[model samples]
Target: MTRRRGRHDGQSGASLHTVLTAVGANVLVAVAKGVAALVTGSAALWAETLHSIADTGNELLLFVGLRRSKKKEDLEHPFGYGQERYFWAFLAALGIFLIGGVLSIIEGVRSLLRPEPLSSPWVGIAVLVAAACFEGYSWGVARRQLRVRARELHRTLAEHLIRASDPTATTVYLEDSAALVGIALALAALVLHLLTGWAGWDGLASICIGLLLIAVAALLARRSKALLIDESAPQDVVRPIRDAIVRPDWVADVRALDVIFVGPAELLVIARVVPVPDAVEVPARDLVKRVDGLRQELLRAPAITEAAVTVEDVPR
Candidate 1:
């Protein structure tokens, strides 16, 4: 149990570090892209700038969620601030959709309706390359942070990237991936504009990038929403937990169980364990010990954070 607690701390720390890196890099990238958009009037550059801004805000929210989640238990909330993590993560998703996706699409459509000749293609290209490098750095950190646990869950890189409940790392990876691809689209548009002397291609590219961002944001929103709505632990996890409580010698039967994720590494579990008919009330004390032992078994699954086992009807 102690070792499991240590691992939980490690997970939170890793999430913090990755999110901070992403936020810092995104600040620089947002400024650079914003300036490039102003100087060049490239629609794609404007789209990228907004993307960075949205990413920066999302990272802050994730960091808040990460930190607030660690708050100690209190009378008002005996279960602690675990749900704070999920709430903020949900906000982060909405931010992605509203600030990142919606704004980009609106700008893209406006640009397409009224084309503007980009003044400096080279400036846009250089900024895009720099943004890509910063995104790569952020992605590297997040990947390293989540890699070990991700493998233990038998998830591939893409699966972890998409399904990770930690918004900080997940947001950074998604934003960075979108930023890299947006750079490509921007460059393509710039080249096309230069080649054909047609300004509409730049706007068209912006629209495409915006559409792409919407798709990514939708995915993030869906996952976060699921977490917020009390999604259950995967069967791979629930089965073993059910098995653990039933294995205890004093337990006659187990009924109704509720498992919830309080934080990325924390779970708030409510289980009803029935005792054997002949088991004395005092022997039930040992069952609590055995149930505590189940913490180790639960930790093996990696997602059940804290389990609360309540013995349901002791034999009189």
Candidate 2:
């Protein structure tokens, strides 16, 4: 299957669109949550405020990664900066863990130790409901993008999100999903606080939100780490590639084939192949020329950025 390069399409790409949608949502939600947190003095609202802020910053970092990764191949970097997405994404995840998760847990412990009376609890609830709408919209955008691609691959959305070569859209999708859940947690904390004169519920909710962020951050970091370490393409790509290598009648057998992801949707292929012997009638130059042509053909697949073929000389 041919995948279009995000750089080639500019901002119209799926990953870019998903990230932009998230940034817009988070900016507005963060402002609302911050105001509500101050008005209510609720631990849960404060934790959610931090979550929205971190998400906004993370999305912006993703934008930077997308832009930088688009730089055309240079002599210094022949493979292009496609993997820049992973590096920035890794950093973003780390930020969420430290800035969002760690601070949230600290805030929760502080609130638990010195329970503070909540003022204007209704206001916090109102803001959280609105925040849910905003976050839900952003999540929808990311979900639609994944659904389209997942259908193309005949894979479930969960399966595609985990294994898809591109992490940009998946990152947004996961963050937005978490945002929606966080809103619910904040709302529940507010309601429970009003129902029972207990600040512990509010503090516990904040801690739960922090743990949630940490889990998501860890998941994102693990995926990015694998990619940064040069993870291989999924089985679907490998199978098609193996078939393509020996499809030409001239190629008798593919002795060995290897494929590695160079970018989100780009791969490098190296293979050794034996050509069908024509009783030494075919010139070595012609045979080599055909083999090279086969290598070039691999470029037709959008995921395949480069390929190298070693052709066995025809028997004398």
Candidate 3:
């Protein structure tokens, strides 16, 4: 089997950095927003507080995934624990939907019904601005990692996020991005409420933040589900392995090739190939030896973590 080099290790390290940074930032921001929400009674601030809380929890889950997925292979799970990332990320997405989206919407509706007067709107705005800075810093870190991964894969930033196999870094990137946008929405609502003396504006912003969180949650859930179900790797990954297997002169045709992502940046390859007709001249023992050698050689190739070869005869 071809052992994965340090490429995946580098990815995991980068993801750990991104998640840890987010956790720290979110914890600080969540506490500040919680205080601002209570003091100012701005519905937008309340919604933002919920958003920050959800993000803090989600980042913690992401950290767990990053750590657990890196666990070495065991007897029960010879393929390793890579799917732990997907499982925890899926739960994190659910948390975003429930805690951030649903609760924010509920708070907005209640605020609209009661129409409470704002006290110290300026305080809320100050806290929001500070939160924005923290979220911005975290967003930049995730973006930097995404850019590097995209460059390595020869893909655009958008493409990488949509089709990433490893969701650890992507989860942080999305949550932080949503947090930044939510801050802007809350900021706008606060300004409008302050100017018009209408608390409805703040309530409306809260609803909008709820919707944004739901959308983000849906996206993350979809990506994680695909990976958990054994989604095939992209064409860019499959094409090269197929080429390598078909390159040898003795291989007349490849009958079948199954290539899949058993883990992040890890692949398991199984192929059935038919030898050229002239191979009949070789003794059975030598041919078996040759086939075994080919299997061993394929295992040494880069990015091929596991491989199986079967030499099939051409049908008469």
For this target, which candidate reaches the highest lDDT against the unseen true structure?
Answer: 3
lDDT of 1 by residue, 13-126 (tens): 888888899999999999999999999999888888888898899889888888788877667866566667667766776776777677777887888788877898888888
* lDDT head-to-head 1 vs 3, winner: 3
Clashing pairs in 1: 267-305, 267-306
What is the alpha-carbon lDDT for the whole of candidate 2? 0.85
Backbone clashes per model, in order? Answer: 2, 0, 0
Q: By descending lDDT, how would the candidates be arranged?
A: 3, 2, 1
Error of 1 at 78 (Å): 1.2
Relative to the true structure, how large is the alpha-carbon lDDT of every model? 0.76, 0.85, 0.87
lDDT at position 159, candidate 1: 68
- Please write out the lDDT profile of model 3 over residues 1-316, one tens digit for every residue: 3344444778889889999999999999999999999999888898999999999998889888888887877679777888899999999999999999999999889888988888898999999999999999999999999999889889999999987887878888999999999999999988888798888988888999999999999999999999988888888777877787778777888899888777677778889999888764689997788777777777776566678889998676
| Model 2 root-mean-square deviation | 2.7
Q: Report the error of model 1 at residue 184, Å.
A: 1.6
TM-scores for all candidates: the values are 0.85, 0.94, 0.94
